[model samples]
Target: MKKLTRLEKYHMNKVSQRSNGKVVAITPEAMEIEQRAIEREKRGHYRVAARLWLQCMDVASGEVERARIAIRRQQCITWSNHTRQGEYSGIGCRGVVYD
Candidate 1:
């Protein structure tokens, strides 16, 4: 079993405290999946990362957190599709050039 990272431990504690210890325990498998999803995101495999993130969301105990993850996953998919089609153009908010 993979040891939990500091961030993961913190997240687990926060969720537990919020739910008064009623939520499911954070399993090593879920952490492993999250790690893999992060790796995929870093490698620009956004579709794969989004899918893995959805899996993580499914295993997450909090409805609000799951919704947040779903939104993030959708954003990843949108960005990935746009980037692949050369539609990003390095533009930031208010038409500012980021690069």
Candidate 2:
């Protein structure tokens, strides 16, 4: 699993702080959109999920929703990098020997 970066942790902490000590229900429209995006992603529709996620960011009205987007976005970036690197090259050792 990819480890969370310091920035990611900071962002998460900020979001948690903004929750105001209560749970809020998202609007049906927003929930529908987010759910659709997740379903599309499960069906291998990456671009659709990506676009929906961006839309969610635009429509999100509260800190909780905004934080969800930020966290998911960061996770996507981390996963993308990890997958891409593994596909292109295997991890190798780096060291110097005295000549």
> Which is the leading candidate under lDDT?
1
Give every collision pair in model 2: none
> Stretches of candidate 2 above 4 Å error?
1-25, 77-99
* RMSD of each candidate relative to the true structure: 10.7, 13.4
| Over 4 Å off, model 1 | 1-28, 85-99
- Candidate 1 residue pairs that clash: none
Per-residue lDDT over 7-89 for candidate 1, one digit per residue giving the tens place of the 0 to 100 score: 97677556522343322225455566777887898899999989998898778765555655666678679978866653554
**10 residues in a row with least lDDT, candidate 2:** 84-93
Give TM-scores for every candidate, taking all chains together and pairing residue i with residue i.
Answer: 0.53, 0.49
Instruction: Report the lDDT tens digits of candidate 2 across residue range 48-94.
Output: 56677677767776666667765655555454454433332334535
lDDT of 2 at 92: 54
Candidate 2 vs. true structure, TM-score: 0.49
Alpha carbon lDDT of residue 72, candidate 1? 61
lDDT of each: 0.68, 0.59
